[model samples]
Target chain A: MTTNGGADLTRLIEPDRVHRSVYTDDAIFAREMEAIFQRAWVYVGHESQVKQPGDYCTALLGQQPLIMVRHSDGAVYVLYNRCAHRGALLCAKSRGNTGGAFGCSYHSWQYRTDGTLESIPLPAGYEGTRFSPGAADYNLKRAARVESYRGFVFASLSPSGPALAEFLGEARIALDNMCDRAPAGEVEIVPTCFRFIQHSNWKIFMENQLDALHPYVTHESTGRAAAELERQMMARKQKPPLEYHYLSAFTTPFNEWDKLQTVNYPYGHCMLQGYMGLRPRDPDTLAYEAVMREHYGAERTERILGVNIHHVLIYPGLSVQPALQQLRAARPLAPNRTLTEIWHFRLKGAPEAIYRRALAYYNLINSPSTMVNADDLENFWRCHQGLAADGGDWVSFHRNAGQDDEHDGVIASRRGTSEAPMRNQFRAWKQYLSSSEH
Target chain B: MPVVIKKRSRKKAITPKKNSFAQFRVSDDDVILREVEQFLYRQAELLDAKRWSDYIELFDADGIYWMPASLEQITGDGMPSIFYEDRNLMTMRMKRIAHPHAWSQTPAWGTSHIVSNVTLEKVDSRTGDVSVRSRFHMMEFRRDASRHFAGVYHHELRKTKHGYTIRLQRTDMVNGEAPFDYVLLAWV
Candidate 1:
């Protein structure tokens, strides 16, 4: 296929391969805001983030700036982060407590947490105009629709669409698996977060989340170093510290990475079976298990503890590792800009040590300053730059393409490194793009 | 607890000239602030050297090490951690990196921890509990590139028969109260 500046969208994307322009073009990005992200059930924030009324956190549902707030009556609402007056952005900070009412900075247009207009700075300023104190126009605008599924908040920009639960469907298991691991059946967001802005299309990240092939190659240097350190510790007859596992996991040869399984679900959701034996007989884990057995009967605890998902992509832009209580929210800044918020949770009531383990991953693998993240960032930037050149027209998802099992709309890749993840994401891209009015 | 710190100051800095070990009366019952300072310095060495296991052993069997999700107190909704683990968490953290599948270590991270401004506070002489405050600058080299990270940590500690273990290690970053910088994989 030759590069066409004015290309037919249909021919550019197949179930197996896609045009590079899908990631590099500027015009396509604008349409994507409406045809896909704006219409999908986008992750906003978790419920526990705003435990009190008037607590709010700013987030992006596609390109729209939205806020997730807990109202006085215990309901969570996703409101546009804009003011009713001169179009000022409310809640500029990523998160904070509003102390019972949201007051916009522009003119102090105070509104209830639910986005209802409470009081205007100058009530008489618009008393006789169409923008009354109680009129909907004077109130903060809200998302087309909002819903919270098991504490994870999701919002749809379009007013009409499949409800959040229906959209999640089989993929709801990703969120469920995380929550189920908790004894109290709940997880709490650790108050701090790590944020990084990647210089790549948002799709590059989503595709990479389940692209099991990259780990062994892209992260070879870090992996080899950690493996050497682990061996050095063992040569001295000393028990190797577990942190080395973080690097060594990447040193696995290509064949070993391919031996693992990857499942590509509908709506672009995908999961990679865990490659590490996280449940080692480490003293800390044994103690944590005892606490779990004490808190949530052994059988139930065992079931919760038994899930083997290494990572999950909640399509579009969420990378959730339920077992480790980690989640990353991706917001596209432009055709070539994306921001990812790295977050991890504490399984409420579990041992403090257990939370620390997740925290280590939060720091080591996902942190913007970590070696792993730095390496990945280089690749993402390179990919975006390369696609914009005359290098190639097609980005192949042809690896193990014909081998994917499609049963009732769900496609499961037999090998871990299979390109089904990219293929599945494109399938969703096609659906969202083709079904749109544009 | 506050009384002990003041008392030690009076005894050590009795004369305006210099605060030397000889200035204070030696008593095994009381732990000199410098001893605690030494413990912290040694811990920093372990981390800088990347002797993770030795770093892990610095904690007691039940010790807790935490890097607050934000600069504020570990309360409410932020992700709330650099780490939230006991020994098991430490073990798992070490284990994952040891695994052949762990990525991110593609280029080994060479880290240097500059721990300074140690504020050694006395918590309780009865329980041998002490609190320490310190500022740190961490620089990591990966793939010929370096990144700098800074934070303050509050450590409440208990002296055990064998050594000292952290009762609580709360890390407050330069961006502690807001959405912060660098995901913390290591114990800062």
Candidate 2:
């Protein structure tokens, strides 16, 4: 609420760099939770996460605990995970079916899947009191605005903002590409996810998403190791497994990474062009292609697969790898802690092997065990620790700074490894944080 | 080679042996159990000492090391897991950790694994296969912080002409689904 005493967000962010306080100061982080996380269109769980009427999954929007549940009417709802009676957590489990309604573990206050107050301990307790059971105040509070774009649900704690569609803009292509890959024109969450806490600021994770320059340098060991294995396989007169490329692709020289472009859209959404050649002419891929052709015809199938996207950074929170059927959602815990939920999806109507391919990539690259992700995670922590100290006053994002081509608000990096995405994100960050006064 | 995509069968790989432990008669159950505990302790020693080569050699040719994301996960199929590595991939993982270019490994991690509560669930002396379960508390220190990882480990061992080898090692951490801090390079 106050901008004095190192809380001035505008003063902290610039075109090509930002003060280290943005990544370290506790006050700035709290302001971020208020201005950016609560007000912005933050992603909730997907629709498929709660497919059944009683299904529910808990998530965090900023610091507020929220639940995304399916009602009996086949609609999804996002409600505060607090009991209306005594403010106890409504759902402690990450996800589970409530049969038909949720009952708070403490007071046994029950609510319908839609968050309506279903029952209380005793009806006569509030008979003549201000607490009317029928009043909306007695029910679990719903998010101010909740919307879904192609089954990927989002919610804003603030009532007024740009609509989700308007906010998504061209970044919707990331979701479209993911769903369009499914022959049935939809995808389903594979249920379990790799959840891990990063000992770094959430923004650090976001900046790393479209950071093309870091991979080949950070993951060099992994890339070279996989490449060496692939070469050994090749020397044995056998083609290497495509999964090897998932790691080896990080060995792509700087020139090749530079060739790919990063498109920075408004609202902090940005995407890097595909560098991982996913469309290999392998047997399993051919089989999957045929399945897609059977459902969507040859031209449409090609169109779906031809949309090349390696990774898409959806502002404050999400980093999506659509082609690989994986997306990571970042939940900021504090100035020094962040939780990331790594989820992988299955394209409906695709071959089981195709699902296997995505799952393999999920395990090989995004999973915590993989050296690819391990490398990034290490840097994130180190960056946070380094920034927290007095050694560095500013974090630089000057790579191809002014070289970006801006057209009608969407900025495209001249080079793949440009820090345009980080700059673009800070641009949106300042806009959101500054506008809180209004 | 040629993208060997091994599709997992829907059927459970290991079922509870039909007859109960009471129904089966094994050759020196106590001795075998003691040997199994010693084998697991030796494996932990190898891993803690960062003996990448000897640690890898403990695995059979067709061995697997899996760390499921959730305690309830039946299989790593269609879902992402913390770790799901075959012997070949596991070898590559070890190699990466040792590579000088692995910047994350600059200050190598020091680990101490405490494998306890060893319990044998099944023993197939005829087939030279055994299933053992244990609880582990692993402490790893790197950089400026130390991380404590506690998990339930399931090891499927096969008797060889020499002692035993690991066919599968699955670690189900108590809070495995929780977000972790930075890298988990050490094998739990």
Strongest candidate by lDDT: 2
What digit string (tens of lDDT, one per residue) describes model 1 on residues B69-158? 556455311243445556645655565455454444445777888888776555575887888788988887765667677888788888
| Local error of candidate 1 at residue A189 (angstroms) | 1.0
For each candidate, report what fraction of the true interface contacts it reproduces: 0.15, 0.80
Q: Per-residue lDDT for A1-438 in model 2, tens only?
A: 234743467888889989888888888888899999999999998999998898999999999999999999999999999999889998899999998889989888899988899998877777677988888998999999999998999999999999999999999888999999999999999887777788899999999889899888999999998988788778978777788898889899999999999999999999999987889899999999999999999999989999999888888899888898889999999998999988888999988999988888888887778688887877888898899788868888888899999999999988999999999999999999888854
Candidate 1, what DockQ? 0.13
Q: Candidate 2 — which residues are off by over 4 angstroms? A: A1-7, B1-27, B77-79
TM-score of decoy 2: 0.93
CA lDDT of every candidate: 0.76, 0.87
The true-versus-predicted C-alpha distance at residue A172 of model 1, in Å, is 1.4
